[model samples]
Target: MTVDLVVRGARVLTSQFMVEGAGVAVQDGKIVALAKDPHLPEASQVVDADGKILMPGAIDAHAHIYDPDYTHREDWRSGSEAAAAGGVTLLIDMPLVLTVMPELARQKIEVGERESLVDFSLHAGMMTSEEHLRRMPELAEMGILSFKAFTTKPFLASYDYIEELLIRASELGGRIVVHSEDDQVIERGVHRVRDVEGRKDPLAHHDSRPPEAEVVAVARIIESVARVGGYYHVAHLNTARGAELVAHAKARGLRVTSETCVHYLVFTKDDVKRWGPYLKMTPPLRTKEDVRGLWEALLTGGVDMIATDHAPGTREEKEIGWDNIWEAWGGIPGVETLLPVSMSEGLRRWGIPPTVLCAALCANPAKAFGMYPRKGELAPGSDADLVVYDQNLEVEIKADRLHYKVGWTPYEGIVVRGWPVLVTVRGEVVAQDGEPVGRPGHGEFVRMGRWR
Candidate 1:
């Protein structure tokens, strides 16, 4: 029987090891074979991947796409196109869901099915009320098994509520994801920065949500989840203290995992001096020392993955920060640059092997979110989601070249030494040479099981 496609002449990188000079065979949207060049099966379609490193298409664990609610900032098509261009095959969006019941989940899934160019998943959240808490099992049955909560505002769930969330979710075979920051500490710091100090500087944003706040919140969640004996993931961890806390929890077999964003790894508090409000993210950029600590944790296995947290804000929304940092939008666009930039920097600066990148950017995230075996592996029976990366291509990031509704990138002018020359999802070529070729509606909504 003729296979649908054959991809030859590249090094295959996976979580455990690299298969040098291997080829992949695909049929019916699944990987059917992986072997050396001459041993690969002849197929209906043959694609050359010479001089490239082939790996599983990245699964972005965190993204924000507010379609009908805030389409001026982003939508499914625009967001997923950016993801495809970046060699990401899946996007797990974080809507900051205040209450994710069946109707709301189905409504968003319908939107994604109609408009996306890549597979997608949703994270339900906010266990502040009995109504919200009661939906966990029902939502899990529908495949939205990961729920999110904020330790601080705009939708804060108190520590008591979060502990209850951890217990309840574990009982129902679900996961709890938290945006960690201590509310009271943030309140005091905000008063210090904006009211007492009368500072509206970009750095003031960092000071207003200090590292101590993250440590406090992370510590509370990790320990609380440990007491209940369940899975917990901390998002966008920015401080060395936070990393240390997560590392210790992991050492104790607490079943806790955490992720850090590319911004935290690349930029720092010092960058605010130049980039100003563009660097303003919640759990804002930390010191260079904190950056080093995050890198250390990542390298040592204390940190499990790296995600874009790809949120975008219009120029008008972000530009207001130059005059009043407090007023500028808190997010920046990143989905388009996540893979290319991270692969380039991770290899060039930190000696991170391609296999490690595959682990963090591909496999580990899939395992954490229960998309493994199907979406994040290159082995047979997995979806033929692949990225062909050229280690030698050098490109500078320019906003015009990126696919964000926002017309700016904080990474503009930073040259990346490598790029994804081609990308595919489920055996179909979706992007090539930095351009997205995938069509809207080609992507389907992905259902997930809770990962134990």
Candidate 2:
């Protein structure tokens, strides 16, 4: 049968291994075949990827696009444009700037369907109220994949509230993703450090949210989930102790999983000192030893996925913490650098396997959130979302060249070895040469099926 597009002569990464001299054929926006046979079906467009790497487009499971509100920092259009430029075909948006109740989730879905340049999904946010908990099943029926909860300030849920939420979600066959940081620990730590002589320094931010806060909260969540019996995911896990807790929970078959962002895997507290508030993030960067332990976790399957946690804020918003560490926004723009940085550091620098990269950035996330086979596989019948990466291509990252509305990157001036030269979402080329060619409103909202 004739096909619409053909990608040939590349090191194609499948769920199992990378196959050389292989070809992937697409027809009607779905992958039809992957083979090395010379008698492959004819196609209208053939891409020669002789010296490149072909894999399923990355799926960023955690990002904040802040649509409908907080557009000054980022909108769905700009966020998806940055995702396309970074080789991310799909991103699961967190609900922070926009309310993620049933009505608001529908509104954000409408915005994404009308303005995003790449595929997207929304997570329902959980608040510490009986009214909010009562709406969990309704929101789940409305097609949200998981509920997001926070254990720290401004959004903290009490232990009893979290336990009830987990039980409710378990009853409805839904999953919960948690921002794991103990509010009590952080509050006490902040009080202890707030009057210190160096409290205004960036390092003080790290001290205020110590690694113990993460470990304590993660352990608490694991205990709650074990008793409640539901699928649980720890979002943006930063500390090695936290990773160890997740691994221990998994060993007991608690249906738990965790993710670590690119920044935590690549940067340390030293970067926070050098870049100041620009590098500041919640559950702040940890020590080099912590970084090493996280890398080891990724290699040994202790980490389930690698996401961007792509939250962006204007320079002015970040500068608020210059005089006092507690006043700055706590996120970094990363939707546009996830794949490049991961490849350079995870593969070239640390010797992580290519298959492992595919699993962490693509397959595992899809399976965790019930979007697998359709989004994470390169086999026949999967959606034809793919990325062509040129490993030898080195480019220095700069904010001016990025697509974030915030218009800056924490990774500026750092040269990364591999880069995504072309990205396609469902058989259509959405980005090329670090610029988005896809149109706004071309993106569609994705719904998740029941996941175990």
Candidate 3:
């Protein structure tokens, strides 16, 4: 039968099997059939993928678009463009340091919709006001997937407000994603570092915001969410101890889940030495033992999701000035490199399988963020979001080649073994051969719960 697009001559990774030399027929932006040797209709637009591996497009579960340093770092247009280039077809942007609260969340989402080259969602943030909580029901009804809460010092929402919102979200059946870092521990740690390191050393940053801070706050968050009977997700878990705490909670079946970023799993404190500023991020990277333990937990099914904590800051902000690590903005731009980096480091080096990659980068994240089949699956009737990858590929990452407005990646000079050669969103090729070809606004604001 004639179709809109037919991707022929590829190995399709499907739910059942990896079909060798498979051809996928697409009609109206949905996968219609997958066959060993599908007969291509005369009228259909056929694109030969040769022997590349066609897998479901990645869904980046966590990111920050429209951050404070938009022009200097990245805006929706550039970030989504980078996502396209990286084989990510769907991205959930966390509400950042934007001025407006929940009211402007929709406006910001609309702004992203106008510029996004791929499907996206906005994970809303919590503000310490009754005014914000009142909008929770409407936001959930509008299909905003989840709300983000900060429990630590720098970005704090009162425990009272957080609890109230958790209760409200429980009623709405929405998940609350928390940045779990204890306020007191972080405050004391920061102060202690200043006394010794004098705040001039960029290394003081990680020393201040230690893993113990994350563990304490994560435990509290789990307990609080359990008390409220609300589903909660721990974001950017940095240590194995933190993951163990989460595992213990899950063992009790408390509806608690957690995620760890690529940096935390691969890099550690010793690696943080020379790259001081570049190594900066909230819940900073931990020790070698921590990294090994976290990987073990991930393989053991103790971790729920993996997100690129892709926060970009300026080179000026990253430099070791008088303020240094204690005052430098904490973040690293990572959206563009998440897939290839994770695949190279996690799957290849650490023995994580393709199935785990599928779950963490595509299926599980889609389910967590309410995008599901429409965004993450390669099955019939799902959106034809796909990535054609050459596993034997090798590339040295250069900052100039990065697509984000940030124009650089913390992962510069790294050699990756696998990378995406082609990216298609809804049967339309958005990125090819390491560059984006898709136009802005081609992406739509994917309302959550629309495709369960």
Candidate 4:
């Protein structure tokens, strides 16, 4: 049968392996066939990949974009543009910056339908209070597949609250994702350095959020999950010890998974000293040894996936921490560079196989977030969202060339060898040559199913 489009002459990544000399046929916004035999079906359109790699579009499961309160930093339109430019076809947004109540989640979904250029979903934020916890099942019934919680101040949930949320989530068949950090440990660290003159140093930010804080919180959350029996995911995990705790938890068969961002695997505390607020993120960058351990974990299955944790803030907002480490915004603009940076460092420098990278950036995230087969696979019946990557395209990253409203990137000047030249979301080319060609409001709010 004739198809809508065919992408030929590329190595196509499937769930099991990469198929060389393969072509993908698309129809009605879904994959119809992965052609390997000489004879091919007639199609209305054909894209010659020219030996580039054709894989399912990357799904960033962690990102903050277009909080109604922080539109100056990033909005849904701009954030989706950046995601398209980075070859991300879908991004699941974190709710910390946005309203996470059920009504707000519905409102954001409406906004995304009118503003985003890529498919998206939102996680409901679990608050520390009982009123919010009472709304958990309502949020789940509204199609939010997961809830997000914090264990540190400004967003911290009490241990009892966390336990209640976990139990409720288990009952609702919903998952919980957490920004795990021990509030008390961090408080002590802050108090220990509160009067010290050295507290002004950017490294002091790292000091305030020690690795032990994450390790302690991760262990606590795992135990809570084990006791309550629900699917749990840790967001933007930063330390090796934290990874170890997740690994051990998984060994016991607790429905737990964790992910680390590109920065944590690429940068260390040394970068915080060099780039200051620009490099600062919650949980902070760790030691070089931790970086090594994270990479090892990625390769060894200790980590489930890699995400951008793409939170962007204006230069002025970041500069607030220049005189005092505690005052700066704690995020980096990364959705536009996540794939390129990881491809360069993970594949070109570290010799990581492309299949492994695909699993981390595409497959694993889809599976974890209940968007698999539809968003992360190229097999027949899956949505035809794909990225055409040229592994030899060498380029230096610069904020001026990026699409973030924040106007800067922590990865500026870093050279990356591989880059996405063309990106398609559901059989339509949304971006090419690092620029988004799709219009605002073209994207739809994706409703995720329950995770098994």
Candidate 5:
């Protein structure tokens, strides 16, 4: 068979290990060979990759897309465009918007198919209604990997309902992604702050939804999963204490895993004063020690992956100095900045190995989310999703330079080392330098086994 392209490189990250001074041969949309001297007998095109790292394309594993009315922050087109520029070839979108169910999930999938510039997947949510719960098997039959549930409210499912949902999902051999925050603890904290400070200080926003709440909720969620003998993943664990709880649960032989966002790894509570709304993610950023804890957890293998938690609510919804903390919407728009910022600041300055990046950012997420060898690794039979990195490249992040609809970034002034010079999705060069070249609707939905 004639290969479509060949990439000769300094280093290529493969499933088992890295290949130095090797070449990757691709045919159709799959990698055909990664050999030291294999002849490209049927090669059609070859690209010289001197002084660059060729790695598996990034899998963001978390995001929200096609949130049109709400997407002044980020949408399918802009999010995938940003993902391509960030070296992310595939991204899994979360379900929690006002429109969320199997049909709505499929509609969003259709919207993403029309707008996304890279490969994508949609996760159906576990809603509070019995009708939605009864449709679990149908969703599983549809090949959605996992069901998402939140332990807290406003729009979250209750503990009783979540437990039942987890049981049903496990019965259907599906995974569960949960946002674990003690609703009562957060509510009490909010009430206490409202009584004392009357929401005068914006910092009280962080103060009210304290880290202890996350700790309490994480432990409880782990126990609930343990009781059901189900696989449960904690999303965007923001504190050292919460991560430690997850670490403990995993050590206890429970099938528990957790993630920390780039913001938690890079920013701290002090940023709330200066960056305010930009830093206001749910389970907000903690102290410098918390940052240290998350890093140590990643290095020591406690944390499973890194995700953007890429919730892109608009600036108008995030105004600070509100008389009530509840009035200020939660979350930050950040999918576009996730990789470059992490590589430049976290990996380069902090000495995090590229293998760790591959695992947390690519491999582990793929395995956990059921994308596996297809989307996460550079090996035979894997989709030809690859990124070429110019490690020595430096760029200052400016709002105008971002591709996400949310034009601004929290790390706007941070000079960053390393840039994705080229990106490929399924053997096609979709992004070059700083621009996306792929057309809308070129991206296709990827399906996973019920729990694979």
Candidate 6:
């Protein structure tokens, strides 16, 4: 049977191994076959990959597009456009506010379907109150099995609250994803830095959120979650001790998984002086040694996945931090640069194996988020979501070149390789040569069917 398309002459990174000269054929938006070119069936359209690396599209499971209310920072269209250009074909849009009810979650999903250029999944969030915790089953039935929780300021969910949330989610066959940091530890640090030390500099942002805060909170949560048979993930884990904690828990097979953002691997608290408030982020960049530890965890089996945590803020919001870092926005744009930076730093400099990188960027996240073979593998039944990377091509990153509504990037001026020359979602070309060619409405919200 003639297929819809075929991509030939590439190193295909399937879930198992990389084939040096591989060809993948697509029919009806699903991968129909993956083999060497001569073994593939005829297709209506054929594209030569020119011996580049063909990988399953990367998935950013921790994106904050902040849509519906905070589109000035980023919207679904801009966020997914950025994802498509960065070789990311899917996003798990974690909303800034709590969306507990299924009806509200469906409305947001419909919005994403109308505006996103790449496929996405929704996260029901901010598990703050008893009433909201009661709504977990509703979201789970909608194919959303992840609930958001926080240990620190704003959502300060008590251990009792978190434990109950974990229990309920476990009962519903769901996972709890938390922003881990000890509120008391952080409060003490803030008092020490701002009140006691009287420091308002950019470094104060780093100092106010010390590694101990992360380590303490992670330890507490892991110990608590492990006892109740709760499956939870540490979002944006950035500390050396924190990585070790996850590694140890994983060794025991206690149903723990964690993700580290691309930024944590590349920068440290030291770089805070260079960029000032621009370097500011929650769970601030850790020490050089901490960055090293995170790399080891990532290359090993300790860290389950890599995420963009792709939160962006405008320049005006960041510039004010020069005077008072407390006021500057705490996030930076990352979705558009995720793959390039990852390949350049992780694969090129650190010698990370392509297979391991693929696991971190693709398979593992999909498996955790319940998207699995359809979104992660390069098998016959998988969605035709893939990227053809020009591994040798290099481009310097600039804010103007990005599609973020904020018009800025923390990675500005760094040159990166393995930029996507072609990106596809469901057998359709969505981006080519660093530009988004797909229409906004081309995307559909993928329902994650939980297998476990």
Which candidate tops lDDT?
6
lDDT of each: 0.85, 0.86, 0.78, 0.85, 0.78, 0.87
In each prediction, how many residue pairs overlap at the backbone (N, C-alpha, C within less than 3 A)? 0, 0, 0, 0, 0, 0
**Runs in model 4 with CA error above 4 Å?**
37-39, 196-198
Model 6 lDDT per residue over 195-242, tens place: 999898999989888888888988988888678877888999998788
**Residue ranges of candidate 5 with Cα displaced over 4 Å:** 14-16, 37-42, 66-69, 320-326
Cα TM-score of candidate 6? 0.98
Instruction: Write one digit per residue (lDDT tens) for candidate 4, span 266-373.
Output: 998887767998887887888988988887787666788889888887899888878876788888888888888887898867787878888888888888878878
By lDDT, rank the candidates, best first. Answer: 6, 2, 1, 4, 5, 3
Q: lDDT per residue, candidate 1, 1-452, as tens digits?
A: 67999889988888888877897999998999988888898899998888588889998899888765678888998998888998999999887533667777888899898998888888887556778888888889889888888988888888998998888888877788899999999999999999999998888998888788998999888879777787888888888888889889988888788888889889988889998888888878888898788777777766788887877788888778998999998988888888887888888887787777778889888888888889888999999999998878889899999888777888999999877878888887878898899888888888887666
* lDDT tens readout by residue for model 2, 1-452: 77999999888986579988887999988999998837557899999898588999999999999887788899998999999999999989997754589989889988999998889887888566787888877887877858888998778788788888788877777788999999989988888888654477877888788899889988988898878788889999988888888888988988989999999998998887678888888878999988888888886666888898888878998887778767888899999999899888888878888888889988998888888899988989999998999989999999998999998899999999988988999999999988999888878888875665
Q: What is the C-alpha RMSD of each candidate to the true structure, in Å?
A: 1.2, 1.3, 2.3, 1.4, 2.0, 1.1
Window of ten residues with lowest summed lDDT in model 6: 95-104
Candidates ranked by TM-score, best first?
6, 1, 2, 4, 5, 3
Per-model TM-score on C-alpha atoms: 0.98, 0.97, 0.94, 0.97, 0.95, 0.98
Q: What is the lDDT of residue 445 in candidate 2?
A: 83
User: Where is model 2 more than 4 Å wrong at Cα?
Assistant: 37-39, 196-198
Clashing pairs in 3: none
Candidate 6 residue-wise lDDT at 141: 82
Residues 174-230 of candidate 5: C-alpha lDDT, one tens digit per residue:
778888888989889888987776765557778888888788878887888788777
Angstrom error at residue 387, model 6: 0.3
**Native-to-model Cα distance after best TM-score fit, residue 405 in candidate 2, in Å:** 1.0
**Residue 141 Cα positional deviation in candidate 2, in Å, after optimal superposition:** 1.8
